[model samples]
Target: MDWFTIKNIDAIDSPALVIYKDRVIENIQLLKGMVEGKVEQLRPHVKTNKIAEVCSMMLDGGITKFKCATIAEAEMLAMIKAPDVLLSYQPVGPKAKRLAALVEKYPATKFSTVIDNIHAAEYLSQVFSEKKLFINLFIDLNTGMNRTGIIPEHATQLFEAVQLLPSIKIIGLHAYDGQIRDTDLTLRKHNVDKAFSKVLILAATIEALSKEPLTIVAGGSPTFPVYADRKEVECSPGTFIFWDWGYKQTMPDEPFNYAALVITRVISIVDEHTITTDLGHKSVAAENPFPRVHFLNAPEATPISQSEEHLVAKVPDASLFKTGDVLYGVPVHICPTVALYERAIVIENNTAVQEWKVIARDRKITV
Candidate 1:
């Protein structure tokens, strides 16, 4: 698989993001090794690459348990009726109400949702009860993200609320602790270890009082190395399959073969100091200082800035490329940038071989 490299994505089309399947599998296998086949569960996050083929590969690699960020992704997977699928995001308001309806239809499927607010918990309790659904309820503990989840201390209260509901069975605790850490290696390690330690305490507390043992779900793409070996529950980390520039540098040795590369054509060689390509922010997420450029015969170049349909990059020896030359860009944010395209043109050595559908991709989720 490593012998086959993506040929030339630019020759195929523009405004396209390409995925190399073999490399992706290599990436998954690399991460899988880090877990040492020791973790009780391994649920790969589907947000990074929503294509069923990629999910199938992860499933093949002893990751039957899968996590998704959207109700739509879960609903789509439920349509296929995939086993052990957990909606990792907090399901609040009417959306979960609509989503809860899905559970009754597929009782064989194991579906889980995260709860942080008692109101949301109470809402789910009623919704699941009304639907006659048996849901594996999880307490979303905010280890470090500070965006969602109840505090670690409040997890027990949320667990108690599930008991009150009766329909929602307390099953797990989830926290994606990677986002809070900075680029610093030691800081990332300390933050990830601290977050998981808190989750460990919550899990122990739940077990001490409740008859049912609680499963802990932690780790993200960046911090999986820290939490993967932990004795706690399972691991679900996205972006590891196709790591971005930010993550590639951070985890240099980790497997990142499955990453996507956007192939762009050099449209305007504005000057010696600046070169322009067909792709821009609309095609790739330019969150980093610049986009990483990977031309076939040349070294990597960085996009200085982007416009609606054009990318202005800083490149040396721009004389080789005319207006018709091609360039490939590795996006900064793998998750969000993957969302920018409708479908991924999967390639092997510059030839378009397969098409992967990006399922359940909704930008605006109305709560």
Candidate 2:
């Protein structure tokens, strides 16, 4: 039987997310092997797979540190008693208070966040100080992503200024070179090195002044291999947990497999060359243009248009397909696609065993 083929397909409804339990475990092992079995140097991000069970699998694999993008994701990791969690986002406004409350609620889990400017740093300090809580922070450096981070040239000055803050302490440096995704491994490495050189210089300057070494957390799935070889850096790659079609086609060097899939069924035959399925924009990640999802069973069917509840596809012969024919599909982007479903059916030994709630998909979870 195929890896995704379920013997009891009749029990599962259409337009449902499914996870292969064995493949997930294997992906965790593959991630560990990439770092030479040193789980200490790894801080896998939880934003990709927001399920608590998947985080528990990483915990079982001896991974203690984690990185998240939201308060809900951080709370999910703390609920599982993850040893350490770094909120990779810059918490501002009421988010600062929410993070402070989360820290007080889960004392067992060490919580930290990233900061790129003095304004955010001062705001976070004020919020944490009012509650008599001390928070750790990593200097978010803009290593060419042009996203949310301080430029390397100005990072040291901000670092020195933030050192005077009372309630927050600078603990590390975070450089997310997400834009350096060259298919050629050599070219990718060179670009990563070029971007990271400034960060290394900043780290050295900060350590010289503070009289301590700064912990470095860097990279995502595409840039993980470049940072894995560095002993001083903690690599954070979230998508390795559930590989998607985008990475598989772009980065063939990484060998992670597709561990999750969306199951859909043919709902109607539009014409001799066209058909519609239950998988629609709401069922998959539609951020990309056409072909948001690739159907494994019906490879020839091309998704031309999608609506809220229907995805119209052009096929060679619609007469060959009838209603209720199950089609297994791999989403082009699995992170947002997983958020569309509240629960995922767990598959074990080709049988539907149980459902795992996508608890962290919510904006808030008991913070």
Candidate 3:
């Protein structure tokens, strides 16, 4: 009768992803509640759950806008007829053209992307202009993540230059404060406010020049609570859909349940203190060190090493386990772990009901 227990799990193959249908719905509700039922401000990123059916569930719950990292995720949202989709990544070269094609194909859905530099913006302008199309853009700000974004000090100049591009329109600012994930809520907010002060100044400067209010999209799961109270900003939290062990440990304040897991079985008995499972590097997110996956059934089984096909673990007593014994595990990182599987077995009321294809996991889906 446990929440993650599947009575008919024997039908599911080993090293497969499984989603609890009801828990996913609960997580969506929790996300909406954080914004006080303001679904308009909830532009969730679909990178965690790439399945079309999962996105539809968010749509059914009155979420219209979405954020994605790739063109395929955008197309998947469009396929579900999502009202608005933002490709958070800056597209250059062929990516810009493929995005333009997606826009033309899904006329009903409004698509936007982020730009950090004028070169990328002008290139996108050329690509969209050739197709006789216009695209909306958000100025990407680097809020200490040092990833792919322009610093706030020099962003005004870049924003002004991008304004001259005819094929692209400046919609707003996109600042991902992904680096502000302190466990203490007060300290986390202070850091977020400190970094976002520059963003606010940049927004004010741009708004004065454009003579229009600018939309601000910001934050991920760890910093979601900090940005949730800001009535004007759109919060993009992806992993809340399928809560993982990483965030669950790091962001203890956010009370999202673990809704997805990898079900694997013991393949061999290595020694009295060691055993191996089918959950390997190919089955889960192996970027982190040992304990990449925590076995829900056998919490003491510590992962010692992982290869492409198997994960060796140090258990208290291997005699307690046998071949074909199933072990439900929660991955430390679920986003990339999800991309490893093509489908997820949907569990409803402790029974495996159906399979939901991880369609958007592919790089190209008829873009």
Candidate 4:
């Protein structure tokens, strides 16, 4: 479907987020093919779309397990009656209490979280104990991404400690290889395999000590394909559903399509070589460098400056464009970009069908 030729473009407001329903379904099918039709092995992170509409699409496509970074996202999944949901973030203080309440409120969905330290686990245990609940958990192992996970060497010790806790259940290990971005398939595979080897060993040790099976959830969009075929590991790739220009340029060999776009309009014609659009930092994610989005119709355009409400771009021939002309752009980072908008315009058959609320955009939802 040519989203650029959507007949209802002029009616919708500028700088609006648009999601192509058909493209999203196609992307889900591609992901299923990657995992050999094993939807249970795919726990897609809902932090990418953050909308129940997309979650329903995933459910319709037979994807049951899901992952999210915030409680709000998990609540959305629970509201939609997702059978399995993993809160892939460490809950601390009140957030820990909130996680317990959320699990209690949504009894139909199985909820879990990740932790790298004992303090957080102890706090979660205390909160869950008060509510008489048991929360499943995965040890967040820092394979190489010095982010929010425990070191590989400490995984066994942390698992042993958590196993004794009364309120939290030690499910398995979570190793997010977000640092591996090599487009070369061989190099990427080597790095991913090296990281997985550490977690696999830890998984074996934990299984031996606990005398039970362990489920390893690993990898993101970049390293998903590398570990999808691993029978023991369940892949949680969020960006595969709504791919962006960032992955397209970095992992050129991947067959995922762009399912979302930021629709902006030319608000002003600065000069013969320049024009300004309504897209700005508030409209799209600005964490990346310049050219935060790729214009599909104007590839020669280079973003010069971006303010809160405008994005000035220098084009090869500004005469070809005029004020009020609609421009569709693919965000470089689709995850955060989706959070910048309150809702998305659902497109199908070159027409706007509905608006899906960005339900989990906020950090908290009164569970």
Which regions of candidate 1 fall more than 4 Å away from where they truly are?
1-11, 38-40, 180-187, 292-300, 362-367
**Candidate topping lDDT:** 2
* Positional deviation of residue 244's Cα in model 3 after best superposition, in angstroms: 0.6
Model 4 off-target regions past 4 Å?
1-3
Report the C-alpha lDDT of model 4 over 1-367, residue by residue, as the tens digit.
Answer: 4555578787899899999989999999999999999888999988899999999999999999999999899999999999999888999977888888898999999999999999999899989998999999999999999988998888888888887888898888888989999999889999999887888888888899999998889999999889887977889999989999999999986889999999999999999999999999899999899889989977888888999999999998889998899888999999999999999999999899899999899887776
Least well predicted 10-residue stretch by lDDT in candidate 4: 1-10
What is candidate 1's CA lDDT for residue 262? 74
Q: How close is candidate 3 to the true structure, as a TM-score?
A: 0.99
Clash counts per candidate, in order, are 10, 0, 0, 0
The candidate with the higher lDDT, 1 or 4, is 4
lDDT of 1 by residue, 85-145 (tens): 8888877776677667767666666888888877887888788777777677788888767
Candidate achieving higher lDDT, 1 or 3: 3
Preferred candidate (lDDT higher): 1 or 2: 2
Give the distance in Å from residue 86's predicted Cα in candidate 2 to where it truly belongs.
0.3
For residues 25-103, write the lDDT of model 2, one tens digit per residue: 9999999999999999999999999999999999999999999999999999999999999999999999999999999
Is 2 or 4 the stronger prediction by lDDT? 2
TM-scores for every candidate against the unseen true structure: 0.90, 0.99, 0.99, 0.98
* Model 2: lowest-lDDT 10 consecutive positions: 289-298
